[model samples]
Target: MDGERLFCDIALAARIERAEARLIAESSGAARARRGDSVGFARPFAGGVASFAEADSPFDKVAGLGFAGVPDAAELDEIERAFAELGAPVQIELCQLADAAVGAFLTGRGYRLESYENVLGRRVGDATFPDGVRYCRDDELETWLAEVADAFAVADTEGLPSHEEFPRGTVIDAMRDMAGVLRFVAERDGDFAGGASFRVTDGIAQFTGAATVPVHRRRGVQTALLRARLAVAAEAGCDIAVVTTQPGSKSQQNVQRQGFDLLYARAILVKGTSAISSSGADSRQAS
Candidate 1:
């Protein structure tokens, strides 16, 4: 990764936010219809997308909001109403670089701060593909998904605990909902040890999420997976790769060690009766 084209600016934030919003939309659109599923959907409002993957699903929230501009009272009211109709709180992952007026608007509407997450980025120039890590084959998609879901089910103790704990099936279903993502698998002694994924949109590669199983933690599995993905991202013509991590967590440290910089942070703010623990954060498990 090089510094020439890498920067932390509103222009860069726009690219990242737009990619994330599109991914959420794709996930919501691909939501499966099952007997008891809550019927997920994504609504584009103001400058971003408000999505619901199911009640309490980590995927249920507003992402990339207010990037285009601050919303009017009517837009905010409709966003709240959409979540209210589903009996879920309105959660917004508001970027720090978003229009300042939007933050005041949210505060006036009684949205309280829940947690914060950091977005790290690096130029995708070149990387050596780590041994034992490779792109997930089509036939191994389910196995890769299962491995990642299982790892994420157990929150990393080195970081602030996750605000939510989803069922194993819910995690898998949520992952399945993401469209056009490239998956990777890391093996140790020929056994599945970890999994990771990234989605490229207009040269920005967003590392969706990654996890190493309990037995594989601290074995460099995630690092290998990360390097493998970075290598692939470069080959795919991506100029930058970004990942979100809980502030001060091991995941954040790991990425920083790989030359990623703290690009920006998103304050997780919410309105309604959802119980957000003071000691928990709203970030994907990436260790």
Candidate 2:
């Protein structure tokens, strides 16, 4: 990989991650705001509240002390406050694009590494729409969401629902009601077979929630849905298309076949709600 392009892609991907987190936060009725170099978000859901990427300082500021150019130690101190304010645990996702110092800082402050994921990206290219692929219409949102939910209901790696059942609604309704999210469904010989959803911003787009039923696998359904989304993104004036996947998963293999490259690996670091015991922040009710 060209070194410059690798860094640029990593940085651009950090921006996309921030946008995605912000969208999820706002949709869940979480409070979100950019404070200095980082964006903080809190939600009422099971997920934790946290921050991503410090803004614009490569150690030139703060006498070389703050991690990722954050103005001071207050960045994380306030993040802790934000999580409590949301009645959630604190979980910060640090992109590889951030300064190495931040990781060390987080570890020193008691955040434990939770998981790793790859942020992949590629320039959108035109592809002829495969047979049975089409942009999902708004009225068909529930159908599209159902197909996607079924695709992901897997109890195993192959995505087969562990309980011999696929969901029909609920989560689909939530996603459909979210702002700025779009879905695309694929048909196989006239039956709804697979689907994916995406959001675009700042000339970039993230293809998310992609899935295909077990019976529909290996039919090129996913690739078709992918290329279709790329075409739509390009026409919408987006240049970069991005996706996040487990580092060594099947989905990574599929997208890599289409020219996508690993931009960076992000670590999900989490701190427990009980960890705040010493900080005396528990009794305070979330605002």
Candidate 3:
């Protein structure tokens, strides 16, 4: 409210969650086209999107829920049926600001709380891309993907550890095919040291993910990447920038240092565990 700072309200949650739903849906559509199959599906349910990128890929979950109120019995049934058909779990990232009825319905149907991810935001203002950070060229896409995937594979011991894991190649493909994504790269001594990305929607700059390679850790690579994306987002006229991060993790700490405040947190709930916990339910794949 004051100074144009964002408030953690239903309106803000709806905007961020809906934008994320559309982005994931588009990314899944792109993945399906690439593989020429029905592996990726985005189903609209409860005013949100229930998407499946693959059995184990991270883009598989229901997002943007509760914005339109709690789902009815039939709507819930449809969502369950859709994921069941794909032999995947019904994973939902329920915003804490969502209607209490929504969480009641989910847990009543056997959805267990698996994890939580904090959503941080900041009003867009002045930002400058630090030296050695720039947009990733088309020719350097593969290298950027490799670095990001590798960084994710090396699990950080702090915060909550991911409940699921995917092959490195799967991670790469997910990042590569994410629709409307803008990629950025950070360098150290003229070598690729880290990468980051963002997507703008309705004046909200969504910082999707960022990571530094193992060899370049603690060298301010992620900080540079974050600044570069913020500058780019401001140039694009975004009013706000947001990122999701594992609670208490280094990523969360890093963004906080950059002036991002905790806008809200998403309670990750799941209904099935027959397969690996639907990967990427956290939204922040690397960061």
Candidate 4:
């Protein structure tokens, strides 16, 4: 397939995996909305809607407010209003086939496009393993969390959620709810170099939270982490695995080298002004 088609497939697969994870975590009431199907929609919180589909499906679960062809500008306004009312952020996914009007409508508003991540993937074809990288089911979760936090220190901080808002504890809790999380850590001379987490949902595994400490850059730790994770996913009966990385970033290059094809990119917009304003009130009260 061509580049765009490949990317779209990968992106859709990744979204399906995320939807499955949410379904697993939702309460019985929300799960009932699924109605024994691989696809369902739920309002996890007031004014916030989530749509999810199981793996191997082309349809997306509208987890937030950004799905493609959302009626018209009035509908968009309604969704945003609902999100604002609930003091929450809206999230959505659209395939590459989505019309240009879809993107234009979102940008026309003051949504402030934030992130564009390239979803990438490769088939579970051959079993090629990376050398010197140790794969294990058990991982040092706390240490890895700290390293991820440290890595984000250099990331753009203005108007973004603080570590406290989406803390390491929250991530651990989310991981616990997943079906299975395979962790691969690469160590050299008994020192931690880098690692990644593979979470499987409905036969599609997602690679999340991959990081290498600053001290271990250019040592092939990240590449090794990808290989080991993919192997595990393949063994787990997964037909495909997906990962998202910043466009043109090192991770993107590494994934490409490992035979993953890039999917379409999605913009990330943050409605942080309201969130920040609300947070300041709490801070003032505490102080």
**RMSD in angstroms, all models?**
2.3, 10.5, 2.4, 9.1
Give the candidate order by descending TM-score: 3, 1, 2, 4
Estimate, for each residue in 18-101, the C-alpha lDDT of model 2 and write its tens digit: 565655454433212222323433332212223322211110001111223532466557756765554555555567776777
Q: What's model 1's lDDT at 263?
A: 89
Model 3 RMSD, rounded to 1 decimal: 2.4
- The TM-score of predicted model 2 comes to 0.71
Q: Which model scores highest in TM-score?
A: 3
Candidate 4 lDDT at 58 equals 15
TM-score, one value per model: 0.92, 0.71, 0.93, 0.64
lDDT by residue (1-287, candidate 1, tens digit) is: 37553569998898899888888877776774433564757888777888887766677888987677777789779878888988999888898888888899899889998777889999887788888988889998888878888788665767655555566777787777777888888989888898888889889888988888878889898788889989988899998889988888888889888878998989889898777553332336557
lDDT of 3 by residue, 241-271 (tens): 9998888888888888888889998898988
Distance from true location, Cα of 102 in model 2, Å: 0.9
Task: Give per-residue CA lDDT, model 4, range 52-135, as digits (tens).
Answer: 222211111233223333445665566566544544555444334345565566556655554444567776654667776775
Worst 10 residues of 1 by lDDT: 276-285
Give the deviation of candidate 2 from the true structure as CA RMSD. 10.5
The lDDT values for all models are 0.80, 0.55, 0.82, 0.50
lDDT of 1 at 93: 89
